[model samples]
Target: MITAADYEQLFAHAPCGYLITDEKWLITAANATFLAWTGYTSDDVVGTFLARMMPMGDRLLHTTRSVPQMQLTGTVSEVSLEIVDASGKPRAALLTATRSVNHDGGVEHRVIIFSAHERRRYELELVSARRRAEESEARSVRAEAGLQHLALHDSLTSLPNRAGLALILERGLTGRAPGASIAVLFVDLDHFKSVNDSLGHNAGDELLTVVAQRLSSTLSSAGTVARLAGDEFVVVEHVGSATDATVLAERLLEMVNRPLEIEGLEVVCSASIGIALADDESSEPEKLLRWADIAMYRAKARGRNTWEVHDPSEVDPAVNRMRLLGELRHGIEGGQLRVHYQPRMTIATSVISGVEALVRWEHPTRGLLQPAEFIDLAEESGLIRELGAWVLDAAVQQGAQWSRLGDGNAPVSIAVNLSARQLADPQLACMVQASLTRYGFDPSLLTLEITETALMENPVMARKVLTTLKALGVGLAIDDFGTGYASLTYLKEFPIDELKIDRSFVSGLGTSDGDCAIVSSCIQLAHAVGIRAVAEGVETDYQRSTLLTMGCDLAQGFHYSRPLAPELLEDWITAQPPSVASGRAAGPGPAHAEPDDDVEMLAAV
Candidate 1:
């Protein structure tokens, strides 16, 4: 194979170039593709060493002693080279080379190269396409993962939500093998609302994220931890003993209680833990969660920062909640609920301007009940939508009755308080319109009162509702103003007709100078905004005097009259002087009070 005749044929007319060298990396053999690729013919390339074709850095690698060693090792896969093309432009390629064998069974030490133009281009295109596909797949994966994460997580804290925890509990309870059990520990942060109220929701969210991380870190080896809305979290320990779960809960509480540096402020909150056993025999995930919830409430009741195991025999709060919801539903439908009107008096004249319609529940066996007893229960159970509708209708109907009963121009405006839930309700506008039409009462005579917190909960939505009500010619008042997180902000956003100073501030108006200043400022703020200021729960003559002196527009409390039935209200209004009735002769509306506090109280129902 090393014959001169063979060499001549290989160089002149052979399918490939051929050459031999003594243990040195001297050129060897090259095919026509290589010649065309490098713009060199046999005369210029045949005896030239491999170093001339290589870059300076690789030139040493193709020296005198390297060719034989490479031949001994056989072919190498995918080796890179930088060679100049016919145009002297740099080209990249992957190559494989093998040593040629001779008839004498000795290594001829010849080299052969297959030009990698098409193969290299194909490989590079494949690599590029693979990279693109990987990037696209990575983006798709990330987006889907983000959506899935959002679906199961709280938007505020990026922690798993109640739905996620339910799934985890289900899997933990059902996926376990025979004899395996799961312990679900429900955790609630103590006084978290105070933190939210005092530090704002942003700080509250930061605290929640920190608390979530701490809970996660605490259960790193124990089980999975998930947030279940608000200040509630759940820890599920699969195949764990009760004692292990209890220890995990204790550690979790400890971790949660650790001070958190949120926005450069140090804050701490204790956690209450409720533990429930979920053995393989359990049928429902809710049962386990219910047990844990019960235990958590028990922990909270026992002074918080503690853990408690679920007690099966005790009355379940879940059942009570369900019962209360049912009662609320029935109470609205069965006419077991009634609206009692409390007269609002003018601060100077003690004359009644309007009545605030308060709801009372007449439980079949529980006698008459204040709204505080069941209104929150209704809100918590999401029955406020229906209950609130009923109250609105009742108040409107009563106002209509008062309008029908009183002389013309004496339409008694009825002010009904609305919860945040009711104001944010999408149907609130329609409901008000429907109630107004149903009772054939003038919308202008129905005053809808909402707390300042209501506006902050969803300002844009609440504004829309208030605007709709205003367009309907109904009066909208911000109830419990100056006692919420964003009273000024609310007043700026919503078109309010009145500002009801919260009872907390009104209770100390005369005694506390700070209270007086606050009341004075509030009245000024309200009037400056073209809204009337009303004082609620003005129980003392001094409070009345102070509010009147401050130019408060309206005042209401037992100092005028407690919430009374329609009959008593009519009789009381008729007892006013005839000239006052003549002053009320605007026809079809209630009489306006010039502000007084000597109105007698009705006996407590």
Candidate 2:
């Protein structure tokens, strides 16, 4: 309904720029809006080519495609192009064009262009934000992966740790086919502490790292190797049999024993391995680890650089021993272990010379158990040190109590046995001194009985410990003397007060002439060295007579009395005849009417 002039005004002042081009694509007319948008006047734009307003790329695109497309369709909508203004400033724009025939029947194009600067800026910002988000997500993923790696791997060696080993073992067991076996090898380095002490911690770490690499490479096809803290590693594998595990362990040992160069020094190392096997899914990860640990200790006991497989048949005894080991801790704290006194008599006088404190475990379910039943287990389980310390304390306290009862005169001395482990402990002398101080007991009143084998194990350390103990005024006796490889030089070197002939030799007294001669020589040797001789296992008058004739100074056996509890010992001591109690030598005659009464009488003396 608008007039021609109003329509023309509307077209000239439109929000978008408008232009009319001829069939040759030259600009025939440009609206005021179009000229203003381009920073151009009608006189400058009219009769110019429309494509000249565009950048070279957009102009080529328009000439090649948009013109042909518009010719077929009569219109092109939303054609994006870049244009340069009259001032040579670039701008993004969207254009729409329509084709029309003028009165002379010539082709002309009407084009509308819109500025898109803010829209382009918004789109670029959106793309930048999306890219930043993707980068942040990637970083988070990498960080999470790093954290997981740190959690499961040893920082020093990059090997999986205990937790990772458990997980691997669990997964391996779970995924194993039925009747297929899963095995774990517990590896422990031997004498690793010596390396640490001799070199330094850094060298030790380097050695461990090299060992770990060797193990990993050796077992690459067979299993996974993991570190279980210092000098301990584990291997998880799916093996066929005990033999397979043993073979693998031997291979690993050979590889490990190969000389390693650490910090320019050639170091040789050895490892002991314990293997545990499971055939089915019912096997527990932790239990398998424990079995491997036990077997590893057994391997260590046999001598290091060896391997042992956990046998199912022997599991009960091993498990029971472990259980007893646990109970032993409770026993020590709960007073289940009692110290029984076995009296040692002066063979010349039949007087109570001293009492050997023997530990007996009054186990709740098993009843009374002797030292022979559990001592080896204790030594193997590392409980011997604790047991030895407890016995030391108890014996010292009892000796003190007896000294209190004796009014400081003729205090009954107590002898306690020490295990090889206890003797090897550097603090043995300190512990002994502490016990003596705690009970206010004279060190001379305490005798520590160590086996000859224990002394011979490391004579240098033994000499040092023995000398320290001797300096504290305590008596040291070598128990079971003839059984070990003790040379006369060793006997002369050690500050020994007594040599107790092993019961094995004394058991054959009077029956075996060779035994008789050995006992005689031991007695003479003891006297020659100015040390007292003690004959153990004297059960008959004939044995006692022979020992006394051989000049043995002390005798202890069932012939005198069995080991007795404290209260019974008190009663037995109170009932002895004064003649025997006053150090009068008893004749080696036939057995008395009441051997128990004789024992009681002997204890009283």
Candidate 3:
């Protein structure tokens, strides 16, 4: 509705400066506002390259960066620049530009400039204020002592994790009074795995969530409750005496003992509690956590739904460890350690592909102990090297014996776990070669499995070690594959033949969308890299079917069979069809063992 003259007036006197330039950035036209802002007449700016009016920093950005970008992309926006005015003073400006072709077939640029002096000053002031406030808050936080970060929180329960619990211990120790002591309570749920096995993992997760809420609400702010792992939680607080700690633990037991409705079923799950009190000012964090753990196990040993307090007047954990170490050395010499084999199946062919060797300690009085009970101890005490060697030699000898079964016997590979400590030794390859030679076992029939986390710890060193072992012609596998942060890049880099998907993800195959996607991607990734993908800890029929559909090459878990004595495994094999017994099964086994033991999940094998 406005006249042509009115439009002309608006362009000349617009709030921001406007200019037209040829492809070379030589100004062909400029609005009156542009000349006024620069304190220059038409004669001073017309026919001059825009770069000449910019400072060195902005000149380079305009010509070398912004101009080229606009020419290619057709636009550039909000580029902050410092321009030189007629008086040779620098002015802060925000620039926006666009490129187009004129009717005469020549390229032209339309440039818009906004004076940013006041806005830039305001932004600087705001940034300065923010930094000062942060500094003051940080100083106050430091005065209050160690505080756990939000990142330390668990994703599932929103409770603090193991690392956060350490910080809580630190802060608690720092503020303790003269003679007063602090207590760490270890809480472990009893028969928790039954919930998972019966109602599935979803119900198990719900029960855990409810328990976390109950514990947090019961303690309020008096104590800190942290989830150490699946069914383990730790409570840290200041207490006057051992008696007081006992009272607190009783309250906790009551809270956990209450029946709750999970998945439409009323479930009564109780906890065993272990309390460790440290009165010494110099007590280490590891000492307290370990003592609490040992006490918790004692409570479990006595019976569930009870509490036990660690008393130094009795056996010390460290002393007990040393004694146990000595006993283990004798146990090894006395032939007390036993090797059990868990069968692994070829998913596609239904063939009994191989068996993984799992070690068990026949601790005279302690009966049979799982690897979890003492593997960490052996590793820390530097005895794993000996333990590992024993397992390797024993497994190789056993494999050689099976190999002599002669014709029609399906060839079976024996897989042995290699601990991180063993992998670091320069002589590991030599030991492997020696074992193969002594037993006359086929190098191609032996598979060595290393955990993904262990391999990624010191990759350069792991690669050097793994390369040496690979030269011996044995297969290599990345155990617990999907649990750690390892990528396909490293997967391809390592000379591994198989990827064992971690059981944590496999368990959720029928329920968790995220887990299913991860499992599928892992299988595809392994296939793409020309490696076989295996799933570990598969229990349900649904999980097995899902993995089969995804083309998993191998699998092992309680769904097939628990690790058994050699003679028992032989019986199990004899019960199978002739095809299965010959390791050339034409179809899947008629049935696999489904165990009722709630503690089977805790077994590393």
Q: Give TM-scores for every candidate, taking all chains together and pairing residue i with residue i.
A: 0.60, 0.53, 0.50
Write one digit per residue (lDDT tens) for candidate 3, span 1-605.
89989978987988788898988889998999889889999988999988889878446665657867985798887777877999999998888889999889999998998778644665687999999999999988976554434557777898889888877788778767778788889999999987997899999999999899888877747688899899999988778889989999999999998999987899998999999998874457788898888889889989889999987566766678898899888888889999887767767545565556689999989999888888888999889988988988888787777678743332345677888889998889999999999989888778788899899888888888888889999878888887667887788788987778899999999899999999999988888887777888878778888999988877888888888777777677667677666544322321221211000101132
> Would you list the C-alpha lDDT of every candidate in the order shown?
0.72, 0.80, 0.80
Q: Order the candidates by TM-score, highest first — what do you get?
A: 1, 2, 3
Worst 10 contiguous positions by lDDT, candidate 3: 594-603
Q: Per-residue lDDT tens digits of candidate 1, residues 214-279?
A: 877766574787877788888877645888788878788788878877768788889899998876
Comparing candidate 1 with candidate 3, which one achieves the higher lDDT? Answer: 3
Q: Where is model 3 more than 4 Å wrong at Cα?
A: 1-315, 407-411, 582-605
Candidate 1 colliding pairs, count: 22
Two-way TM-score contest, 2 vs 3, winner: 2
Q: Candidate 1 versus the native: TM-score? A: 0.60
